[model samples]
Target: MKTTAIGYSENLPAAHPEALLSREVPVPEPGPRDLLVEVEAVSVNPVDVKLRAGAPADGFRVLGFDAAGTVRAVGAEATLFAPGDEVFYAGSIGRPGTNQRLHLVDERIVGRKPTALSFADAAALPLTAITAWEALFDRLRLEEDSAGTLLVIGATGGVGSVMLQLAEALLPDVAVIATASDDARAARMRELGAEHVVNHREDLVAQVLEIAPEGVDRLFTAHSEGQIERYAEIVRPFGHVVAIDDGPRDVSPLKGRSISWHWELMFTRPLLETPDMIEQHRLLDAVADLVDRGRIRSTAATVLGPISPAALREAHELVERGRTVGKVVVHGWEEAIDSARESTDIY
Candidate 1:
């Protein structure tokens, strides 16, 4: 059988109208410990833009990571889920992504979809939620009940939106100070439980210091272009800092203050095939529970209609601009079942 998909054969900027293309690809069969998912909804992320810009020129690169779908088949060794189970996951960077109608993902990296959310809403959580959960609890080693100040830079973006709520729910005693340049974004962050909101366009140090004179105890940076060094100055001695974006950086300043810099990539475990790969499954399950219990909400702010090349390209453009407040999702295949069956299929 085959499935409809949107992908690219060449690395073109999102500015090009042909950057993404709609095609039909063979439905991938599950490997041991994998699940064949009939994708229901998918969300765009910054990583999707980055990967598409550098996609290989030979084979098409399907560029989606966050997906919510139902299990259609399971690998011989897969025991976590069976056919018809609703699941969500951030697929590995090593495989064909979740942009297709049928996707095969390791069961170890998949979790039960949130009961309270539609597939589109559940689709928005995996990548950002896993990134935030690992960045705070694993990389920063923040205690669940600890009392300290956490300054989240770029606090209204997809990851930041979920991070704010997770920090508030998991670290109840900690003061959450989020940075948003505009009043609307600031208000959104506050609504997500940020105790304080500061303008990132202004002097970050001054704004943070005004709230916590002693300096923030931890820093989670979702956007750090030329401001990495500033984190060293504003973070308290021995404080931890986690960054998700990739760029050339000078961390020499952090050493003098005894501050530690950590990098977080949600794909790390599956990309490396680590022994702890199953941790993603556990984390996603916990996040699903949180969402169901109303401890956290879906961060999907835009729904770009059905999964088609045109819709996906529009979503890509929005993400590439770096101005979207929350996650953007696309639901279901655009083509009718008969049309999809008649389309050319690439193996």
Candidate 2:
């Protein structure tokens, strides 16, 4: 059997007509510990844009990472899920992505889809939720009873939205100061339980100091480039900082205060096939429980309609612009469009 997918053959701008194209490709057979899913919905992330821009000319690179779908088949060793299980997961970065109709993902990294959310809503959570969850709990090492001030930089994006919710619900005793550029975003952050909101376009240290007179105990930054000095000033001595973005930087300032910098990538577990790869499954299940219990809500603010080349390209452009407040999802595929696309699938 085959599946239709949107892919780009070469690097190009999102506005270009050929940037994303739909074509037919053979469905991958599941490996041991894998599940073959019939994808129902997907969400776009910054990683999708970054990878699509550098797509090699050799073969098509499918760019989606977050998906909510139904399992159609399971591998010999995949005992975690059955054929009819509804699931959501951020697929491994080492393999083909979740853009295709039928996708193969490791069962250990997948979780049962939250029964309370629609497929599109659930799709928005996996990538951002896993990234934020690991960044706070694993990288920062902050516990539920920990008492301190946390400054969340870039708090309106997909990851930050869920990050704010998770921090608010789990770390109830900790004070959270989230950064936003405008009143609307600030209000949204407040709704998500951020204790204070500061304009990131202004002086961050001054705004942050007004909330916590001494300094923040931890910093969760989505924008890490050229902000180390500011972080060093606002973050208290012996504090920790976790970042998800990468760029050239100097760590000299952090050394004096004993501040530690940590990086988080949700794809690490499945990429290395780590012993704790099943942690993702557990965390996602917890998130599902939270969503069902009304502690957390979906962050999918933009719905771009069905999974066609046009819809996906629009979603990509929205994410690349860096202004979207929450996650953008493209739900369900158009059968007519898929069956009609005749473009050759090279890979």
Candidate 3:
């Protein structure tokens, strides 16, 4: 059997409309501990853009990270999920991605879908939510009772949207200050739970200092244009800063201030096959519970039709423009399901 997927034939720029195309490939079978998911929805992320631009010339390179779907089959050792389970996950970079009808992902990296959201909405949460959660709690070691100011750069983008809300929900004592370029973006940041929204277009150090005179205790940068020097200046001595962007940056300025720099990549565990890989499953499950309890809402701001090559290309274009306020999602498959066995799972 074959599955429909969207992929790139060459490393072409997003402006080239022919960069992405739909094609059929043989459906893959599951290995031990894998779940063969029938993809229902997917969200376009910055990683997708980078991968598409750098795609190999020899063959199609499938490029997606966030996905929500139903389990069509499970490997023998995959005890976490059975056939017909509703799930969401950011599949590993080492494997073929979720921009296809059938995707095989390790069950350890998947989570039960949030009962409160649609497939498209749930699809938006996995990658960004995991990044934000790991950045705050794991890298920064932030606690619920931690006191002092926290500065979030790029406060209205996909990762920033979820990070802001998670900070407010998880760290009640910490003051959440965000940086945005315009009034509209700043207001949207505030709506997401930022206590202070400063303009990033201006001197970020000065703007942050005006609100936090002593400097912030923790900093999280979702997107930085070589702003490590600015971060080093605005963060207090011995403060912690986490960055998730793949852009080149200089961290030498942070040495003088004794500030600690760390990186958060949501794919690390799955890619490395770490012993603690199951932590992603646990974290995602917790996030889903929070969403169900109304503590956090889906950050899906744009829904761009079904998961086809054309729709996915448009979604990638929006994300590449770098001004999207929240997550962009594409739901459903291009093909219709003819059997009840494939359509019964709903969470």
Could you give candidate 3's per-residue lDDT for residues 230-325 as a string of tens digits? 887899999988888874467888898899988899999999999999999999999999899988899898998767778888898999898777
Which of the numbered candidates is closest to the native, going by highest lDDT?
2
lDDT per residue for candidate 2 within 1-347, as digits (tens), equals 77887888989998788998888999898998999999999999999998888857367877789999999999998899999999999998888888889999999999999999999999999999999999989998889898888899989888888999999889999999999999988999999989999999998889999898788999998888888888889989999998888843787789989998888889999999999999999999999999999999999989876798899999999999887888999998887345546433422
Task: Give lDDT per model, in order.
Answer: 0.89, 0.90, 0.88
Identify the runs in model 1 with alpha carbons over 4 angstroms from their true place: 336-347
Kindly report which residue pairs in candidate 3 clash with one another.
none
Q: Assess candidate 1 and give its TM-score to the true structure.
A: 0.95
Error of 1 at 174 (Å): 1.0
Worst 10 contiguous positions by lDDT, candidate 3 = 333-342
Error of 2 at 182 (Å): 1.3
